[model samples]
Target: MHMDEYELEREASAPIDMLETYYRALGWEYERSGEDEIVSTFQGSWTQYELRSIWRAEDQVLQFLALPDIRVATEKRDAIYETIGLINEQLWLGHFELWSASGLVLFRHAALLEGEDGATLSLQQAETLVEAAIEECERFYPVFQFVLWADKTPQEAIAAALIETQGEA
Candidate 1:
């Protein structure tokens, strides 16, 4: 699970022209959707995640998203909303948001930059932001599964998902 070597190499290569450089250096499959948006995919232990980064130059914010592509049934959304709230409370950075219109759940975080800093972030910061987003999504993938497929309550799902086993089975 340690990608430190890859991140370190990218972080030391040069200043980041865009956040996607960090992902690209890691050999992530990605493309530019626009001048401000980059979309990529990452394979996790539990799922394939669609990752995106958008640079809001006017606002000086770089926003990242990681989607596991789970679609919540309308009937399950209320529970999912509760599940999202519970999961977000445990997160120190970024948050899980249920896109009500699309019934999609994804992780979102943003790096706010000073106007003088422009749209570019240091490679280290870029690595931290992108990796943290992906890690958060990976960490919580099962919590949503427990809610959607197992009928577990938000509390129960969070409790189950957060439990750490001592040794490999």
Candidate 2:
């Protein structure tokens, strides 16, 4: 499946409420995660699907979306690839790839889609999401840069990578 490409623009910093409102206007449901994070869910049979945005201590904004299909827990290898393709196309991202351990599909900008790492969404759309997330960070905290990721699994490989790196260091 091939994903669609969209453009994202950065916006002024604001509170999560503002970001929630923006996404809500786009027909997404918002749920509060931690003190400075939010998970936005898209409506439809695609329930349990959510986008998470986190504001770090230094004001860095991290964003990503998770799409899970529990029914494919024990499917074959090719099925997993097909699932990845399906998600890539549905999200309209540039590219999608599979993760080894968790079997998740990561989406991001095509440039970052290399290796056995994350996937790539359209840089344009990512810029937009980051801009929104940045506004929320500025309102609630102090945000520096906006980081975004997308995956078909509920687990976050980026977070896992951070933890592993920290432990190793």
**Number of clashing residue pairs in every model?**
0, 26
Q: Write the per-residue lDDT of candidate 2 for residues 1-169, one digit (tens) a residue.
A: 2222221233323334445555655666678865656777543232233456554434233444343322223344454565445334534333345565665543322222222232323345444664443322222110000011233232243344335545755
Give the candidate number with the greatest lDDT.
1
- Local accuracy by lDDT, each model: 0.79, 0.40
Candidate 1 worst ten-residue window by lDDT: 9-18
| lDDT score, candidate 2, position 76 | 42
